[model samples]
Target: MRAQRKGPRRRRALITGSLGALVFALLTVNILLGSYTVTIPDFLAMLGGRTIPGASFIVMETKLPQALLGLLAGASFGVAGAIFQSMLRNPLASPDIIGISYGASATAVAAVVLFGVRGAGVSVAAIIGALVVALLITVLARGRGGTGLILIGIGAAAFMQAAVTFLLSRADLRNAQDAMVWLSGSLNSANWERVAILAVALLFLLPLTAAGSHQLHGLTLGDDTASGLGFNVPRARLLLTIVGVLLAALPTAAAGPIAFVAFLSGPIAKRLNGGVASLHLAALVGAAIVLAANFAAVNAIPGISLPVGVVTGALGAPFLLWLLISSNRANQGG
Candidate 1:
C-alpha cells in the first residue's frame, strides 16, 4: 500500500529531476563552452566578480544573456504549449501551430519595420498582437468547438506569416536586417535588458499558468466532462488561452518566435515522462532544447552563427511531418 502510494510520485520526481539536471547542464555548457571558452574555474571567478580580460566581456555580455534568455523563453514556450495542447486535447493545438507565436511575430515585425519601434516597445506590440489574435480566434470559433478553433488558428497563422513576409519586403536594408531577427528568431541581440524583461514577465506569468494548469487534465477529458468535474469550461479555457498567448507572445517578442519551442516541448516532455503531460517537465525540456540548439548553431560552422530559430525549424519540420503521419495512421487504425 505504501509503495503503491509512492509509485507515481517517485516516478514524477525522478523525471522532473532528470529534466532539471539536463537543463542545468545545458545552461552551464552554453555559458562555459562558447566561441571563447571560459574554464569552469575562471567562469566561477568571473561570476564572483573577477574579470579575466577578454573572457569577462564575452561571458558577461554575450553568452550569459543568450543562455538565460534561451532558458526562460524556452520554459515559457514549453509551459504555454503544454497548456494549450492539454486543454484542447490536440497536439496541433500548440501556440506555434495555432498562430499565437506568428501573431506576435507579425506585430513585432510591423512595429519595427513600419513604425520604427525598438527596445521594449516591440515586446509590448507582441503581447498586444497575441491577445488580439486569441480574441479573434475565440470570436470566430465561438460555436465551433476545439476543432473549429484550431482550424481558425491555423488560418490566422498563415495570414500572419504572409504579413511578416510582406513587411520584410517593403523595408529598407537596415530595417530589413532588423526585421529579419523577428522573422527568423535570433538570440544574438540578447542583452541584460531583454533578459530582465522576459524574466520579469515570466515571474508574473508563470504563477498564473501554474494555477490554471491544474484544470488541464479535466479539460483533456472534453468540455462536458470538464464541466461535470466542476471545472468552469469557458472561464478556465479563456484564462488559460490568454495566459498561454502571453507566454508564447512575450517570448516571441524577446526572441522572435524561435521555431517550434512551443510546438515541440509538450510532446517531447510527454514522451520523456512516460506519456504523462507535466508542464514543469515540459518547461525544463524547452530550456534544454533551446540551449542545445543555440550551442549547435554557434559551433556547427567555424564562422557562421545561424539564428537559433533556423536550427529549431530544421529539427521541428521533420518531427511535424512524422507527427502527422503517425497521427493519421493511428486514426485509421482506430
Candidate 2:
C-alpha cells in the first residue's frame, strides 16, 4: 500500500518538475532571442542593475516585461482552464471556448473602436466584460447542470463575437488595425505597467484558487455526491467559477485573450500527468506554451512577425477537432 501511494506521488512530482523546467527554458529563450539579442551575462547584469549600453535598455524595457507577462498570463489562463474543466467535468469547457474570452474581446474592442479608449481603460473594460459574461452564464444556468452552462456559454460567446465583428467593421482604418491585432492577441504592447497589473492580480487570485481547488475533487464526483459529502455544492461551484473567470480575465486584459492557452493547457497537462487533474502542472505548461508561441511568432518565420494568438490557434485547432471527434465517438460507444 505504501509503495502504491509512493508510485503515483513520485510520478506527479516528476511530471511537475519536468514542466517547470520546460517553462524555465522557454522563458530564457524568449528573453534572449528578441530583436536585440542579450547574452546571459548581460541579462544577469541588467538584473543586477548595471547598465550595459544598448543591451540594458532592450533587456530591461522590452524583453524582460514581455517574458514576465507571458509567464504570469499563461499560468493564469492555464490554472483557470483547469478549474473550469475539472469543475464542469468536460475537457471542452474552457473560458476561451465558452465565451468568457469573447466577452473581454468584445468589450475591449468596443472601447477602442467606439469610445477611442486606450491603455488601462481597455484593460478595465475587458475585466468587467469577462465578469459580466460569467455572471450571465451563472444566472442563466442556475438550475441547470454543467452541460447547460456549457451550452449557454457557447451561445453567449457567439453573441459576443458578432458584437466584436460589427464594431470592427464600423471602425476607421487605424483603429480597425489596432483592434484586429489585439483580438489576435499580441504581446507587442507588453510593458512594465501591464506586467505589474498581472503580477498583482495573480498574487491575490492564486491563493483563492488554491484554497478552493480541493473542493473541485468533490464537485467532479457529481452534484448529488458532492452535496452528500457535505460540500455546499452551489456555493462551491459559484466561487470556483468566479475564480476561474478572474484568472481568464486578467490575462485577456493584459494580452488580448491570447488564443487557446487556457483551452489547451488543462487537457495537455492531464495527459502528461497520466489522466489526473494537475492544476500546478497545467500552469507550468501554460507558461511554456505562451513563451514558446511568442518566441515562434517573432522568430520562426523570417522577415515577418505574427501574433501569438495566430500560432496558438494553429496549434489548438487541430487538438480541438480531435477532442470533439474523440468525445463524440466515446458517447456513441457508451
Candidate 3:
C-alpha cells in the first residue's frame, strides 16, 4: 500500500511540474509574438529600456495588457469551473453551462445599452446580476434534481441571449458594432487599466477561494453527507455560488465571455491529475489554456488573426457536446 501510494505521488508531481513548465514556456512565447514581432533580446531590452520607441510602445501599450487579462481570465474561469463541478458533483456543471456567464453578460450589456455605464461600474453591475440569477436558480432547484437546475439555467441563458439580440437590433450601427465586438470577445482593447482592475479583484477574492477549497471538497460528498460531516451545506453552497459568480463576472465584465476556459480548465485538470480533487490544478490549467489559446489565435497564422474567444469556443463547444453524449451513454448503460 505504501509503495503504491508513493508511485502515484511521484507521478502526480511529475505531471504537475511538466504542465507548469509548459504553461510558462507558452506564456513567454505568447508575450513575444504579436502584431509587432519582438526578438527575445529586443523584448528584454525594451523591458529594460535599452530599445527604441516603436517596439517599446507596442510592447508596453498592447501585448502586455492582453497577456495579463488572458492569464487572469483563464485562472478565474478554471477555479470557478472546479467549484461548480465539485459542488454539483457533475463534471458538466460549469459556470458557462449553468447560466452564470450569461447572467453577467446580460447585466453588463444592459448597463452599456440602457444605463450607459462602463468600466468598473459595469463590472459591479455584472457581479450583482450574476449573483441574483445564481441565487434564484439555487432557491428554485433546492430539493430538486440536477436536471431541473440544468433546465432552468438553459431557459435563463436562452432568455438572456434573446434579450441581447433584441437590444442589438435596436442599437445604432456604431453601438451595434461595439456590441458585436464585445459579444465575440476581444483583447484588442486591453489596457493597463483593465489589467489593474483584474489584479485588484483577484487579490480580494483569491484568498477566499483558498479558504473555501476544503468546504468545496466536502460538497462533493453530497449535501446530506456534507451536513453530517458538520458542514453548513446551505451556507457553503451560497458562498461557493457567490464566489463562482464573482469569478465568472469579473472577466466577463472585463473581456466578455471568452468562451470555454471555464469549461475546459477543470476537466483538463481532472484528466491530468487522473481524477484527483481539482481546486489548484484547475486554476493552473485554466490559466495555461487561456494563455495558450490567446497565443495561438494571434500567432497561429500570419495575417489571419481571430477573436480570442473564437478559438476557445470552437474547442470548448465540441468538448461540451461530447461530454453530454458520453453522459447520456453512461446513463443508458447504467
Q: Pick the candidate with the highest TM-score.
A: 1
Top-down lDDT ranking:
2, 1, 3
* TM-score of predicted structure 2: 0.96
- Show the colliding residue pairs in model 1: none
Q: Tell me how far the alpha carbon of residue 19 in candidate 2 is from the true structure, in angstroms, after superposition.
A: 0.8
In model 3, which residue pairs have backbone atoms overlapping below 3 Å?
A: none
Question: Which stretch of 10 consecutive residues in model 3 shows the poorest summed lDDT?
Answer: 26-35
Per-prediction backbone clash count: 0, 0, 0
For all predicted structures, in order, the TM-scores are 0.97, 0.96, 0.94
Over 1-334, each residue of candidate 2 has an lDDT whose tens digit, in order, gives 9999999999999888888889999999888876668789878878988998888877788888888998999999999999999999998899999999999889989888999987778878888899999999988988787789999999999999999999989999999998889789888778999999889889999999889988987998988999999999888987998899889988998888888899999989999888988889889989999999999998887877788899999999999999889988998995
Give candidate 1 misplaced runs (Cα > 4 Å): none
User: How accurate locally is residue 291 in candidate 2, as Cα lDDT from 0 to 100?
Assistant: 95
**Comparing 1 and 3 by lDDT, which wins?**
1
